[model samples]
Target: MTGPLDIHTARRRYITVCVLFWLPLGLSIAPLILLFTERGMALAAIAGFFAAHSLTASALELPTGGLSDVLGRRAVLAAAGLLNLVALTLVGLGSAPWLLGLGMALMGAGRALSSGPAEAWYVDTVQEHSGLDAELRTGLARGSSATSAALATGTLLGGALPWLLGLGPDLGALVSEATSELVLPLSVPILLGAAVEIAFVAYVLTALRERPRPAATLRDVLRGIPATIVGGLRLGGRDALVRRVFLSAGATGSALAAVELLTPGRAAALTGASESGAVLFAALACAGFVCAGIGSHLAPLTARLANSGERAVMVSLGASASGLLLLGATAAFAGVASLVLATIGYGLIYLGLGAAGPSENDLLHRRVSRSGRATALSVQSLAQQLVGALTGLIIGVLPSGPAPWLLGGSMLLAGTFLWIRRSGPASPTEAATPQPHTASSSPSAVGSGPLQQHADQ
Candidate 1:
């Protein structure tokens, strides 16, 4: 009998979905960075924009996530893509700061709309077709890889397009020879990205599919917000293991966001490479993402080798924190080589995190009811956003120069230590156990014991 999830079909679907989803994100990066630069905006202004963007998206995440649970994932995803198309268009055209901010806010709304639903759709669809256990790792890994690939392609295009279009340094030289007017080259990529987003929306509306409706009614949806928040918290609170996972994930996410925000400046300063330096930093970050994708692909193997999900999570977090610390410290005192090395470390950490993420998600999913799963996941999403916002805010308040490195390193170290403390120690014997059995098993299996034991090991 054919399983609901045909691996080949699911892989194609996952890749297609990721491309549709991440292309906008990838296209947005360079253009947005350039947008701020072209507009003569300060880092503070950009940070403010990001903070507001994240806040608005965070506000909308729960409701939108619940909507996906009720209304149908495809509908939500399509809406998200359309929203992105509109947002990117506005961003491309707008010259004024207010207009740009408005566009950014709209983009954030689009992001919120898309975030939880798309992942849920992928997971649910694959599980329905192939079975959860069979499809989870491959599907998630492929999705992550597809997103990274889109990001890499977009970053490269974003950097290369202006130069190719006769709007870059060569254009400046040409203009000096003629009109003596420097054409702002950054806007070109923004316009191009807007075009790409428009195409993505069309693709999503045409290609994306949804599972059967899992929830109905506005009340049901509204009720899900509190239920999800409380239920996820309750579940995490009760389980030491789950709580550790959430905390570690949240902390790592915060540190990463901070690192991302600061690294470009550090790269530019250290390399003396100008605006193009930031683009290089972005490319390096994407490299880390590629590593992460590879790690996610190898997650099953890493988990097997490590012997426990908790240990894998802990190791990944530690590695990521170490990378952040190294990046910050080296960038503070050293040159471009250190920056590159830091990036390499960042890549390794991402790979580890990618490998661990599925295991952590699987652990959480096991603890929550189907009805509440989306909501619980939304809470997790919220934690990530909240942490990101906090990190940005902190970085904004801190002094410049190596301050970012110090702050990032401190947060990472603190977060890592806390995660380690929360995770505790795993015995060597505990890890070598076969699949479908956890360390915390009971001799007398009863009711949910067998399933729980299977999951835990």
Candidate 2:
């Protein structure tokens, strides 16, 4: 963590960080809403809880990304882990609504803090040894695969733990009694997530080694962060390729929003009962993550087959859009064929998104130098989150049919078309050390962020 590492060492550490950082979040996913319901929160309150988390993360994304650029990746990541630790503990143990809400906000803050630093650290490490010529797709792909694997594994474990405990002499009751009704069975996964967060912090501190930035005063950070943010905002305008990446992220967010919004009720309808539907949805969710992991693992081959990173993004996203269209086309049907097609479409959606991610990021990395890497990533994240939220709002009001699915697919398809031609940089890395534009050429765009560690982002 303190010295220069070889590329192999760096890749290994990057993969480890991905797994450790994501596993705890995965653990909480299956049971978080369930835990809230167990604690007497109504659907409205639970929705409010999530909104608080989303808003907090969104608001903090750009600033936190700047913080990482100004501070160091390791420091910001460690701080994120610490915040998650406290957040998880509060969420698991607190009975009061306000305490739970505060916990969620803190978790959002932690998410914002952690977003881009880990990957930025990996890119920096590789670039240190190999300079601008490093083959980053492999590392990024593997890290992404590890993340999906951790999520799939954690989802299974989180969902099963409570049931397993219940089957063995009422262990859950005993724990609740011991804690005076505070530690419910549903709380177990979140508490375990808190424990895992400890490991995440330790690993981040010990494994994600980065060359330190120069020590600076508070004044420097205040000045540096805003200036860095401004420069990052200009990144998209100055670099057309990076703009494509940002817009593509928004398209992805839109498509994902549609699927997430529609999938649950579809599952329930298929199963004919909410309980069975919940079980089926969980299974499908786990399967989707596995498919995404497989796609990530195959990203290198995907790039090779498509002949270029840009082409690979086009192919991958096109496939994803096609899947959305399939869903939309079959929305009015109900039969074995419909079910089979729907399942295939679901798998394709995740797989294509997963495959496209590494290639897209490889392009982004090549365009930006170290000075504003994390901030660039934050800008991408913000676009995705903001656009996805907007898409979700629109989807919410639409009548149940293929319209929503078509709308999402069309948006993604439009984004895919943006890659039909090169984005007009004579050289891809022309902006590797980019600067903000002068007054004569002023141009704008990014907001304040997660397709991050979760599919839900």
Candidate 3:
């Protein structure tokens, strides 16, 4: 990592990191619920497991982000990978309720630690090589695309592995017998994911080079993080554009929560059995990831087409909202047409979010300086995660059917509207946003007179 790399090399490394980290999560998705059930866990217990994951991630988001800022990207990322390695292995092998729960909480901690470090590292590297006005959209978008592609590929493979093993003399049964029922067919994906985590950690340690931060004592590291955290917290309040971006992140979260909660049951209903429903859902999930990858790949073009990052976000989010609305509008129907529309709606949800993410982040990166970059990204993630959790709760309590879809769509629409008024001084003719003053402090120091002028303009 000490060796100098061109921006192309940096971006390629970043994309690879994205794929390596995200693919494992994707692999676990297809078999996770079934695995829990196979272990004799009820719906409530399964929900508790997920709640543990979310709660742990939510609680650690800021601290972990600050950890990255205070420590360095490579170390934090490697730690995250190691945590995920242990977490996935434990989840794969452990049968007891507490073991599984602890595994999930560890997984969440891994997730929180992994969130923004790689991207932050890339951004930092680009600035070092290309100066202050480095082009970040392409790298960010490519990273998003790589992540989506990994998920899609992993979904297909993970979903197929168990079935493939089940056929031809039932290798899965043989494995179960050999392992004394400790490792089921469904557990293979997770075990494979754990192996991948090892690779992810190794790659991150070697590929994501960073200039080492000054070696600080534990107390100094501790003190610096809070100051950075406080600065990141104050960031959105001071910068109007940053605030809009965070709000938009929340809206995206709400929409995503609705989609994730509603889609599985809806698929189950359509297929008339949980097993078939799962297959259909896996296929749909894969397709959604593909669509998301395509959207991320096209994000730069989307910005150009819409004229500005602001407009692109609006258009992308609006498209997503419309998709949700379509789902809501067709909720009462029962036909192939309804199914097709629902499928399209699902794809659009991922696609729009994919496209919107890069554009919104492009706007965000311009305003925040180097110091609090990861912290800012973590805050953005926190906003999304916390809001998504709340949204899930709200959707759960609400009566089923179009109500959930409508709630999400309405919230996304409101977020879209935030961009319509153009709170920042983005030009109608240009796609890139104006950069902020690079004051060498945290984000609280980032938005002073210059950023105020940006809002006014």
Candidate 4:
């Protein structure tokens, strides 16, 4: 507290926080849909469960950000971890539809609670430690890369653990009298996830600290949160650039939902067996995550090469859409060739998303003040969740394969056009230049002038 925060320290903590929070999520993903089916839930019901999770997360997103801002990021994040611990436990044990849905709702709440607080803490700490004009791109990019690596690693582990368990002792037979036959294998990854959530809580409690806010009090915090939420809501309505970014977030979310919802099944069809499909999907998922990490690491270079963040986003989104189109086009093919194309397409989709994320967030940070930063991020998340939910419902009704991918790809392609109509704030490189600060009475006053000087650059 006495010394200024070093950039390296800030960056390390940011990446660590991201890994801790997202790793459990990644672990659960590989087994989640299959687990539900193993428990005998119908397709429609499974879709409902996913929709419930998304709606819960979307509804709570803005309010939880307010909670983070008012109650302090550490406390809110700790609570989120605790909730996730409980949720993962319930999910691991519960076999009934209602119970599973309840677990999902709790998981959504935890997700909403955890979404933006850690990143907000990182930025606030960095700005406090190293002045407002300090370099942020490299640190942010590293954090994104760390998250993708965690997902890639976790997905592979989660997928392999169950099969590995089956290969070992008959743990399921021991519990067969107490639970369903498939319970033991399906529960392993989620139980491991619950354990990780415990670690996440402990880390948040011990590692993160809030900067002193001399003027902040219980009454002021309660009053300010609502005002902050309103300001966040106004961001999209009032700012053309922010609105365009929000639209893109929605479109990208849909594309992601398509891949996540459809790809495992597609992978299974390629192998013609559930067990083998699961294994193949796991390998593909891991590879996809690696590609994501590579893309995230390349974001800054991509932006510089394109001469602007907006241009970088378009390039990335175009690549993503093209990948999805490749997926759709190759749907009719069978055997190793189809599998190869699908894998490449899936990897490219994640690559684009991973590359676009840091650039998008960097621009967003320049547009909003610290007071509303978390809330703005929450809004961005809300857009994704809302669209993701819609995408799930649409995909559920649509004929399997190709059709959903085509729709998702079309939406992503449309998202790219949003940038053409509006110019956003200056690119990250331009914002990294030194600038003077001005004192203002407004709580939302932040050093963003240099951040917005794209016209001159």
Candidate 5:
């Protein structure tokens, strides 16, 4: 058997996987909506595409977690990468809205499949080797930073590529003609994303290996998955901390959905052309990712300053809500100043979220056992996706401009209060070490807790 994994090795692998997983998404983010419009899709049709992706992802989140838990992380991740490859290809090449929707569905499935496995694997490996109290915040922060950095790099390059191609030799036009307009200049980034998915698959296959579990038939997985899903669901109801985390995740999701749904159109209006807007949005996205990277890099320091993860999250939420409020307030103004304010507000929101995520996850890992790690993460992701779906619907009906941002800001402000007080004092073990023993585990970790009882039943 291989030797136990070291923390440094595990952390390095974790950050590497994070970069690989997120880079393709960053590459495609600049052009996805613009591409649909380029192909003659309407506002409602674009909304439907996003809704379809969200619904598919949300529906599969729990099941995919169970699948990862039962089947091991590497397999599920590789499967996701392969699926992403197909999805990106279709999206890059297809013009019909139905075809695009089909591609988006597959992409959502890939997202669901890939969601928790890498981080789960890292947490599991770390806890196994370093014990449950291992200092997770720094490593998690670094991973988050790496992800943001990848996105920033990808966005800048992807955004510039189309503009660059059109300028030099009119290469985009030649390519568009050659492919019968299936691969427009805007489509190049997504097609490039497909190439990166291939790399993701290869990396996962080679870099990740699970400790051997007892050999079991396919029957074992089939039976265990539903049970795991049930256990994951019970966590929110039974544990105060878990419930709060779910609530925080949902609120953040709503805020994000509003920004993403509204901001691109506003940007399109600002630039006065669909094509120019795509480029502008890409640059803005790059800046936002840079801000997020800075926030992630500062998370450990934030936790120290706040004196606890809970306070850190509260502070982060407040910052995000403040930014959203600013965004809402500036919506009516027109000109360079308003655009600059909007961009700053958008960057701040991302920055706060990036800072909050690692601290929040650090607490989550403290609460969960290795066995349920992926499932717990999945539950968190499910809350985000479900709330995001609802937020999209709400935004669809709302009047354009500040209303959606105001509503989202209000929700985020409410979430900030969830962590104002602790459920109880941290036990001696929890207080003393980064890793907590079972007796001193977060409220969610109580063995005889209601969630455990529900699991038994």
Candidate 6:
């Protein structure tokens, strides 16, 4: 009999869950910023909140990821959704810094708990139906598209809602009404998000079925951690291609984070617009999301056109670097035309990056063993976070106008380096063909042909 965890069903569920999860996150950003401003919080304090949350989340990621290996993906993800519901609720209600910090920490924990497991679940489920190669690109594309759509919708609503509510207030009552309006509109998504998450948890409980975990002691689980970490590191270290992929991913992530941190300020300066300029920039950001969503949906075609996964990634990175360069130029020159061109460039680059995401992820999965997958992924995640944090700190301390130029230049250099290092000419083993999928076959029966062929040579 065909398994319940078919790729088509799983993909739909994955997209649904992503939309629900991201809507709240998207909505929360504006409120979080407003709250920070309202309280007269320092940049350092805001940075501290993010840093503390990331540090704690990083600590838990590995352990919980391992737990997913032992306990199963569905259980872990359901728990994560519930945790996010609580955390988002707290964030909406919080007025004090300590309370906000607590909420942020909880949010981080929820993110940590959810991050690797959902992907793992998708891959595992899809592989059961269609095998890895068939599902990998399409699955990632669908998920990315869903996430981008969620962000665009949430941001548009978040940016517009305050103004909509602020319109009706009488002159004497306007200030109080506006403040109250601000809180509710921003908080609405989070409340709705909680309900969506609960629904997702229920869906997962009913829909997802996987192989039961093998009997193991708590000691057994703990003992696997060291070996798992060592195995992941060894696999990446020994393989030049894998090492380059990690480096490229880390660099790209760092560059993207730097852009996100600096872009709004740059846009405001270039346009000579006040804080209200943020709304326009926010709209631009939503446009970028739409671009990314479209690009991800068309990733398969892009990958084919590029000839190889490595080349696709290079194209993506190169586009992003170019976009950043344009952004820097626009900021320096300060013209409306330049601003429009820069936004267009940035959106296109984001699209390319989204296109490359799935292929890169598939390459990682192909190279690593199932037992070490989450650990390997966690290492990559940690590297990206570390690099992003460092980039943010450096930008903050230096405070140079040319910082965007430097960051863009660095991304270009990194992408060029990876392109040069491309695992030249796949061996006969490396070029092994993927197997076709059929609905009647079990996952294990579907295809070991390609992987086995690759391993043999």
Displacement of residue 74 (Cα, Å) in model 4 is 1.4
In order of TM-score, best first, we have: 2, 3, 5, 4, 6, 1
Model 2 clashing residue pairs (backbone): none
Which one wins by lDDT: 3 or 5?
3
Candidate 6 lDDT at 102 equals 79
Top-lDDT candidate index: 2
User: Can you write out model 5's per-residue Cα lDDT over 394-451, one digit (the tens) per residue?
Assistant: 8889998789889888888888889898765433234222222232112112121211
TM-score of 2: 0.94
TM-score of 4: 0.86
Winner on lDDT between 3 and 4 is 3
Over 1-457, each residue of candidate 2 has an lDDT whose tens digit, in order, gives 4667889999999999888888888888888888999899999989998999999999998988888887888999999999999999999999899999999999999989988998989998998888777899999999989999999988998899888889959999899999998999989988999999999999888777778666767766777787767867777776577778888988988998888888888889888998888888888888888988988888899999988988988998898898889999889899999989988888898898888889898888877767678888888888888999999999999999899999899998998898889654344344454454232121111221111222332
What TM-score would every model get versus the actual structure?
Answer: 0.79, 0.94, 0.93, 0.86, 0.89, 0.84
Judge candidate 6 against the unseen true structure and give its global Cα lDDT, from 0 to 1: 0.63
Please give the lDDT score for candidate 1.
0.60
lDDT of 3 by residue, 1-457 (tens): 4655789999999999999999999999898888999999999999999999999999999988888877878999999999999999989998999999999999999999987788888887987898757888888899899999999989998889999999989999999999999999999999999999999999988788887666767766777677767767887887678888888888888888888889889889888998898899899889988888888889899999999888998999998899988898888799989978987888887888888888887787667666667777888889888788899989989998899999999999998898887764633112112223233222221222111000000
Best-matching candidate per TM-score:
2
| C-alpha lDDT values of all predictions | 0.60, 0.83, 0.82, 0.75, 0.78, 0.63
Off by over 4 Å in 6: 1-4, 39-44, 132-135, 167-185, 271-274, 424-457
Candidate 6, 155-223: lDDT as tens digits: 777666655655665331453466654445445545555667777678768766766655656566565
The TM-score that candidate 6 achieves is 0.84
Q: Write down the worst ten-residue block by lDDT for model 3.
A: 448-457
The TM-score obtained by model 1 is: 0.79
lDDT of 3: 0.82
